[model samples]
Target: MESNSSLGTALLPEESTETSFWRKVLDVEEVKKQVLFSLPMILTNAFYYAITLVSVMFAGHLGELELAGATLANSWATVSGFAFMIGLSGALETLCGQGFGAKTYRVLGIYLQASCIISCFFSVIISIIWFYTEPILILLHQEPQIAKKADLYMKYLIPAVFAFGFVQNVLRFLQTQSILMPLVLFSGLPFALHFGIVYTLVHWTGLGFKGASLASSISLWISLILLATYVVCSKKFEHTWGGFSSESFRHIVTNLRLSLPSAAMVCLEYWAFEILVLLAGLMPDAAITTSVIAMCVNTEAIAFNFTYGLSAAASTRVSNELGAENPGRAKTAMAVALKLVVLLALVLVLALVFGHNIWAGFFSDSTLIIKGFASMTPLLAISISVDSFQGVLSGVARGCGWQHLVVVANLVTFYGIGMPIAVLLGFKFKLYAKGLWIGLICGLSSQAATLLLITFRTRWTRIDLSAEREQGTLDSV
Candidate 1:
């Protein structure tokens, strides 16, 4: 008599077949396991979101002008930092996932070190962007008082997270090796330290606002130290010291190569939204308070972080299967990720929708702005769904070394079409806030469609294992 486990195996027939892809994704039992892995990722992002909301609420106490300054400055900081980080980490995803699939442990450590080295270089560049932020604000014709505050915020905030990014890239590299808990568990360390330092020193110390920002910088470095210690003690870097070989430099080069195109694509998309926000601030009634606008954008961002977390996991999963020469598995993994992402997005949107009237109470007590934000629920729903698809496809492309195409597609979709149309609707049509968000929908929607189409039509089966095996070159992704 066949046991139940053996009978189940007999019913399944095979693991690697393409026909089995759907079953692997949908099997009631397997589906539960995949969704379960995603839960920790969701909770981790929820903590990060909580930190942002707390920061905003506290900044709101500093007054509307200060809140606006924080909003604009943090917008720039978040988008630019993301562009720079993704420019490098995309390559780490590809290399480490593939290396793990191939059981090449030494290559994994080399990739990690190279990514950290380049991330340090970028941290310096991002800090300088802050220094020049004042001139850019002036060029945008921001009010002089607001511009001064925004510049201060930019300068102070960018440096706070500089060294911290190196730790994040290392975490992403380790994630591809499938040991993700250390990275996930320790991510909140920086925030805890940041809150304690900023809260205590901001009031107790005489340093004022600059003191608050500096405290965050101190916290960031401490978190970096803690994570770096874990990496060293975990023995994850042992085999990577391959005598300063050219291949090591190539790993750094490879990360940037993949990262640059992806960055260009995403940066263009982000810049469109930034432009709209600026345009909204330029409108007549906007100056009374930008709080309504800030709440709308930032609250939605809390949800967007989930997409990022899942995308990271998807990139590794798809890349691993591809490296193992299991295209069927890769396709299955992407499908599973896509479905799971939308499921998560809808669940989140429902929470946002049901709590719509009450959402802004946490950020501000002004009933008027809360009403304005409640009106924005539908747009938020559509936008989150659009952005979710774009995120997943980017993951799929990264897994397959399709970085260059993503860049080109994003450029055309965002700048070539979406931005032009968005600006026309925003400034010329006189639609104000509604127009700005509508434009965002256009930009992200087009980019998402292009990514989905490109990923779907390609033949995922022809993986070049021997070429990847070569130690000489690693291209953009």
Candidate 2:
């Protein structure tokens, strides 16, 4: 194998042909580095998701109606606010990760600012949507009671939208520099505080469902403040954190050229599940079906956090290698990240299979709801496993600046193929939630396969790292 000095390590020796592939994979120092880099990110993502799950659990304890309402509101928030902000901010993963590796330090801060600005602008529009969520839900033919309560719940979550945008911006800034510990510390600490705040507001203050929403918003702002403080005070960012600049505004269009497609790719995948929940709400037993699917989806979200961390690590590693003008190392990084995520996925699949009955009980005491969730585990396992690979592929695409291509892939597979199948089996054939989830599995599988083929066929050598460098320099000028 060709050696890649840019990784500060060498690939497996070509002469060592007798060595087993798995052993060579394990022995590679770069693989270990990638795992370590992703570990903290995974933990941080877990805590972030945990905070939301806790809110949902709190709502579940109040009543089934409350649970359904909270789930609907939360789903809308994710589709309208969180996914868009996170996806748009992913432009940083490409720009900042490569910038850091290329030693173009200042560009990272500039990109971070640009992403923050754009995300904040979009948040305003999303917040307005949230303000009218009740009407929107009614328009979609949702149950009137659930729509009313969910709208009330979404009202308190509006502030968190902007806070979330800032958090993503700062997180990307630190992530690209290989700074993972602060993210863990800040996110984990707020998550602990979140439970207490939620309990107090919901029980002691008698705010009910609104309290749970407020708790989520408050926790996000706290995390955002802590992270922002660290970025300002930490010496690690001395080179990257040049104070705010007018350049951020100027680069808005340039950054959107990447961010919009990224947003589309991510939103399409995320909204597909949200749409599943919406479809379930219109089924025979709206409350039970929506509640059950929401619980299962939450479980999948937790697992997705693990894969998402791997994706982030892949993006950083691949972008770093490419920025260093080592396409060979970039390819190696992708291969290593994929292998690690697949192993993790298999382990998760087994755990979900064995623990399905027990896991569903965590969210609700209702036997019917637990049984409903358990029935979906097999399909969830399949979807989650395939989605793990798809997630990392998306990260790789982001690093390679192939966001536009993936957007097309996501739209075709998810909408053109998956949605029609879901609607057919779910409603026409009356397979209900199972049919919807199975459709999602098919969509993920198609997306994963398509991305894999693209990665395989890519001409990495054709990437013009110098031209990217020149463009960044010109933008700064």
Specify the highest-TM-score model's number.
2
Candidate 2, 110: how far from true, in Å? 1.1
lDDT of 1 by residue, 1-477 (tens): 569888888767565465678665564443564565555555555554454445555555566676666666666665667455645666767777777776676776677777777777888888887788778777887656666766876676676556556756666666677665665566576667667676765567775555545664565566567777777776655653333345566666656766667566666766766666566567775543355666666766777678866776677777887777788877777787788888878887888889988777776666666787787788888888888878878877777778788888988888887777767776799766766677778878889889989988988876554235554543322
Tell me each candidate's TM-score.
Answer: 0.87, 0.94
- Ten contiguous residues with the weakest lDDT in model 1: 468-477
Residue 79 in model 1: shift from native, Å?
2.6
lDDT of each: 0.68, 0.86
Question: Once model 2 is optimally superposed onto the true structure by TM-score, how far is the C-alpha of residue 33 displaced, in angstroms?
Answer: 0.9
| Residue 281, model 2: Cα distance from true site in angstroms | 0.9
The sequence of per-residue lDDT tens digits that candidate 2 reaches over residues 181-276 is 989999999999999999998999979888999999999999999999888888888899888898778767777877898889899999888898
Best by lDDT: 2
419 Cα displacement, candidate 1 (Å): 2.0
